[model samples]
Target: MSHKDTIAAIATPPGNGGVGIVRISGGQLESVARGLLGRDLPQPRIAQYSSFIDAHNNTIDTGLALYFPAPHSFTGENILELQAHGGAVILGLLLERALQLGCRQARAGEFSERAFLNGKLDLVQAEAIADLISSSSARGARAAQRSLSGVFSARVNALVAEITSIRVFVEAAIDFPEEEIDFLADSDIQQRLQQVIDDIETLIVEAHQGRLLRDGIELAIVGRPNAGKSSLLNALAGDELAIVTDIPGTTRDVVRQQILIDGLPVFVADTAGLRESEDVIEAEGVRRALQIQEKADLVLLVLDASTETPENLPVIPDPKRTIIVWNKQDLVAGEMPLAITKGLDSVIISIHNTSGLDVLKQKIRQHAGLNEASEGVFSARARHLDALHRSEKLCRHGLAQLQDFSAPELLAEDLRQAQQVLAEITGQFSSDDLLGEIFSSFCIGK
Candidate 1:
């Protein structure tokens, strides 16, 4: 895990700030530090005010230099950090001076990658660092922090241990057939297998919630012309984001607005009114609206309560995924229409007066599967969800084989495959390409 060459980069964000940092990590940090500081390295883990000198022995910048000796640094190598005034020119000069001292620029996520390679962090923890940095919501950030603290990893490891114990027992029974233990027929073995399946199922549900937190749900608004589609977008966004007019087909393109519904991020897309139009642009807009509707996690079907009914509306491809919103309640006289209020998934609201908006927000949160209980969940990526799903499927298949056909060998193989799939989450069985892909997405100097 030891690197031969030194790597350096401007650790802080690019811009003017109160202070900036140039970090270097590798075996040659001692020489790098001495060359830049123009003096002997400071005591390990202590910050010393020093002058950053160039190769010509001219002072490039005055900064605080902190040194961390080998085996005690973030990358598990000798590390040096130079904190200088937050000026682009000064930071560039410091970085250039370090490069002159035989240090190369670090790539995107190289610091975290080195940490993972040196056994300082597991795959989940390393990825959690990136997730924490890129999180858009406060709840998402907290969830990522929990994952970084090893809450998620500990759970995965416990499951791995349980599966490993079962595999060992099954393999032993296969190897020692004359023991007369009847391992396959034992009720204890069956119970253990069932418990493992149950655990996997539970984890899958939690992971799905975590993934939703990490990547918020997409909601598409669709309906015929002048059905308050644009009005609803502006109302949800709490501003005039989309143009509203009495004329139909005013919005010829999709208008997107990202809003937080009860701490849960909801990407709301207001699409063009669905209708047959002779105008070329409107027809294209209608086509794009349909495309967005198909890909959305949920579709809000806006209806003009003043006139339109469910029977006259366009057929929804999936009624379960569609929420019927009765808009213009202010224009309607007397009680709400039976067609709009009859359905459990329907909500009556007036975009002009902002009535029933709270109920609509709650419905959005409910449909997104996020609630107060999700506060304790950890952040997870789509890839992690995919792995968990595969592992769970394998475990269920193994359980079925053992229970119905009494095929111990097939069951053992299924368990092994499940174990391997789960191992990928923690990098125990991850491929090199997968590692590269994961780290490549991280920001530089992470």
Candidate 2:
């Protein structure tokens, strides 16, 4: 818990700007400040415009220096901020001066890591800061903000408390043994377990939606050549990102466009026509299309309504996860066997006339399991999802042990393991390697 040494770095983004900031955090900030300012002016939270002199009392650069005392500042340690005119050289000079004063340069994400260590922010909040910074949509940003504000952590903590209460009762029954007979028969215990399961399921649904927001959905467009694949891509993206031509085999490679629909990031991949071909390039494209379909969250099956029915529509992976889009529907008069695979399958649309595109977009959102009308969702990484899944599985195992009236010790052991997995999600109990791996992903100076 006792972190040694001071870490310093230019906190602002790279490149020249009107102004830039260099930040330092740790124990030796006061001494480092005194050395650079040539005097002790550690007025916590007060800006002191001073010269950034070196150990030899030579001016490094003039800047406004501010200090934040421990337990109140970011990283939960003494922090120093040097705000200087935005110049790569000026910030570089300031950083060099700090390093000379025995302050090591800050590592990527170190500041957030320190915040986690000092209990200023939990693991979820720390990750949210990154998500907020890199959010692609307004909704995603808002979700990250809620997570950073501890909304997600609060919910997780409440669930953990609920689990703990159940665990305590189960363990107590094992120890007392006298109450064991009646305890196993109590319906209250079963009710509490069921309620907890319901809560976990709800969280899983919400978190999965949030995950889609963060990771976005991968959609692959497939059909025979001249099926209006490029046109559909251009229409959805609202730009001519992919080459659009009337030729049957115009697109020879997979063209990808990332666009936001209803504030959800969607990767629209326009692939070459899915069919046997003699051209080497077209063959490669076809192969790539199949591969993309395997991992795609949804497949936009574009069928040219102007032409004959597609004799061989590509076999979609996870049919439940696909939406068969009948494009160029305007060419045909009315619906003709529009069912792609039944009610759970497809939708008809006219990309040429821009008809039914709204319906198509809505369907995409639904396929992603996203509630587009959602007021808010907490951003969660795949790692958090993994942890939650493992915790849920173990909890269910514990529930089974209880229902069967098996050995109480078996139930207790499962609960203990489940608790540890949940604890890891919030950083309640963490390993050094995990800490290192998480923080190292951040850019220097956080």
Steric clash pairs (candidate 1): none
User: lDDT by residue for model 1 over 166-190, one digit each (tens)?
Assistant: 9999888878889876976688888
Give the alpha carbon lDDT tens digit for every residue of 129-203 in model 2.
888888899899988898899888887888788888888988888888875545667878778877877787788
TM-score to native of every candidate shown:
0.97, 0.95
Q: Give the best candidate by TM-score.
A: 1
Q: How high is the CA lDDT of each candidate model?
A: 0.87, 0.83
**How many backbone collisions does model 1 have?**
0
Over the full model, what C-alpha lDDT does candidate 2 score relative to the true structure?
0.83
lDDT of 2 at 197: 72
Model 2 stretches with alpha carbons more than 4 Å out: 54-58, 179-181, 334-344
